[model samples]
Target: MLKFQEESLRQSVNGALALRHQINPFLDAIFEKGITNICFLGIGGTYASAMQTVSHMKEFTSMEVFAENAAEYITTGNRRIMDGTLLIYSSVTGSTPEIVKAVEKAHAAHATILAFLDNPNPHLRELCELCISYPQNEQLKLFMAADRILFLRHEFDCYDDCYENFDCYLADALISVEQSSDSFAQEFAKKHCNDTLHYFVGAGNQWGSTYSYGMCYWEEMHWMATKTVSSGEFFHGTLEIISRDTPVTLFISEDASRPLSLRVAAFLPKICANYTIIDAADYPLIGIKPQYRGFISHLVTHAVTNRIDVHLEAINCHPMEIRRYYRCLEY
Candidate 1:
């Protein structure tokens, strides 16, 4: 682990596992009260995680789910959002103005609020009907919350077995990702150290990872230009931008959407001279079951791609922690 703290990562996994107790009771109370729809509302990475969870849930469950941008949802409300809605808001800082406003609006509408926070503001914490504070594994918290909701509603029959294996599977993800960092990810970073722009492509649940990496990691952290497109949408207009010199990165997951990534892979090599494919299938999983691979593919790809950040920092002579305009300036 080059930039990762082992204790912090272990603590995060344990913290997320402990949330099952808290989440079970919260869902018990919500189902007793009756919830009609689930809405995951946030900005940036939080919202992207919500979208990924929504896609994951839709594979088996028939629940009404929506992932919305906090600021946009406040301005143009969804008709399905009412008193019976379960609104989930994720923010580590809890000081994000847009999320705070979304909480207030949901509260006024009598919607039930479930928030994942780190050191949340007193006002924001008070507003939530149920709050889970775990700063390290925010994505895991969201995924677990969504999965629990599905199980509670009687959508996922095997949820108990899945629940029992949460800690083990997540630990596997943390470990496998570190192993991947030392191998393919480091090589990819060193190869692309001089590249200024990148085009990212993914499909299914991985589409969220592509978007999150492009915006949160590349644009926000590295101050680089990145264009992320879904594999299905890459042909419509995005394919025209592909040239012999384009720096393209493709994310291949082992889900039902593997065919979509395969299609892109088949086409890119024929046209583009500079392109790299990072497939999650290449990673080894010691403890994870074969059936769970699709469910955990996003985490594996995220772990692999994130390793490049540390390498890019060393090669490009810019620390990933340096941000010029995120919180330092007014938006």
Candidate 2:
């Protein structure tokens, strides 16, 4: 049972990475037009992926990036959907109704549709200008999406060595995988499972990190009540939730988001005995050898995020089929 679960996890990672491989060239072609603006239409894993893309594209390219939430896109006004925009649509199964509608809107406007699809969903392909297959998960498919960012932002040849070791690294993501280090998280989860509220703390881009791990995974694995507010956000209003009755998990990024993640980490230990703090520096599961540590960290974090996603689907009837639903809803 565990082995099957592990394969399921690795397959999700491998499947998403494969989609990135196909999407890169198409993205290159669209960017070649030197379009001034970029728009991403998505939610959940797709939204998370779009955020990473938005962050990276800003640092490396001059394009103005905007991400429209899927809900808004489903009901947006025609003029509100601008022209000359590069619409990057992400639907893991290629069948989100809102995304499909967004794609149609972009089509009517003559916008370029660069999609990340995991399967051969014909309707999505028919709607898009370039429909490339890439798996972005429903809740926490950030790891695979992070790699798609790296592929677009950095030198591919430099990181080509990275994919070679992915199978081995992913194997470790399962309990038998090398860096499971399951004790701390398992014990911490046990003590706080019944606790109704929890806070996820992280600094830098680590906000995304903890958001994926603490909120996404907890929601999947144990159906734990999780709120994914950043450290800064945590200190804002919800910090009142920090108490003996409410446990917290602090997810910090090493070089960035640190000052805030650490600051929040320091504050929570004082109020909550059930508090558990995990510094990203001490965790190697987030480390993907043969690549830059930052890239590896994002990829490893993504794998764990995806794993929790698989575990959740297994326990529930929530099959990952965003594409299938869209076909029914659209036509």
Candidate 3:
């Protein structure tokens, strides 16, 4: 709890839970229209988290799903995002220019848009057929929205029973992550404050955390050099750059790909001594059932990383809010 606010986080979690109700009507509307494919679009860290959520949807559901960068989709264009496509947009600020443009493009293509905006933007909300506003924790809101859609479509089998216990599950998840903030994150930050150019790798659904932490936190927020490699692809080319002094981190989840992450965790310390592993198994997920750990592992991982970000901010003598280019200067 070095730089974290417990009450604020609880409120954010509650706001995310409220999205379940806000998103149900949209799901009903889209299902009635016979949603053919789904597209998740956002900019920056939102895009990174979307990749993980899309991976989760793809793993269990038969629906055609995609996660796209808002800016790149504008240039390349996805043919599948037309007519019956259920397009989801996420913008924590509701003011990212790229997201606003992507919303317009998707709307013009006649896709039914369900946007999760953290802040109110009338212009952007007008572009969407349905919009749900939440205060913070945009990634969790978007993931739950996607899960709700999958649940309504009978695509996510664990939805009905697991969802009934969601309130407890969510509260426990946040608490477990809170408990680790002081122990793991603070210690890690203290030991590795001077290291630059970090390398992070994760597998399966957890790979999204790898990308988000490296891209959004390390590189964007902390202004440090970092590379995110998928666990499956790490041995292919990324391992060649390893050195004893390299600051390599591995994110492990309890899902099916836990073994995949374990593979890297075992290999990294053999050649590189400066490696660290942050696995969800280490945390006490109080209210979450053992069988459903995989589904919420991303959330837990993200929460822990949030702690690390704050600790890094304190140690580096730089606040996480400081940015030189993002929203500070035109691209």
Model 1, residue 284: C-alpha shift (Å): 1.7
lDDT of 1: 0.83
Q: List model 2 lDDT by residue over 1-331, tens digit each.
A: 3124655656766665555456656666765665546776676646655654454344344446666777676675445455567677667666666677777777887776766677858987886777655444432233334344445655344435665565446445433421353344344434554556666665444554566565435554445567777777778887876777576677665443457777887787677777666554565553355233443344444443444444455444445443333345645
For candidate 3, report its TM-score: 0.96
Winner on lDDT between 1 and 2 is: 1
Clashes of each: 0, 7, 0
lDDT by residue for model 3 (189-300), tens: 8877777788999987888878988988888888888999999999999999999999998999887788888889889977998898888887878777888778777778
| lDDT scores of the candidates, listed in order | 0.83, 0.57, 0.82
lDDT (Cα) of model 2: 0.57
Which residue pairs clash within candidate 2? Answer: 19-134, 95-323, 117-134, 143-302, 172-177, 203-257, 204-257
Is candidate 1 or 3 superior in lDDT?
A: 1
Worst 10 residues of 3 by lDDT: 163-172
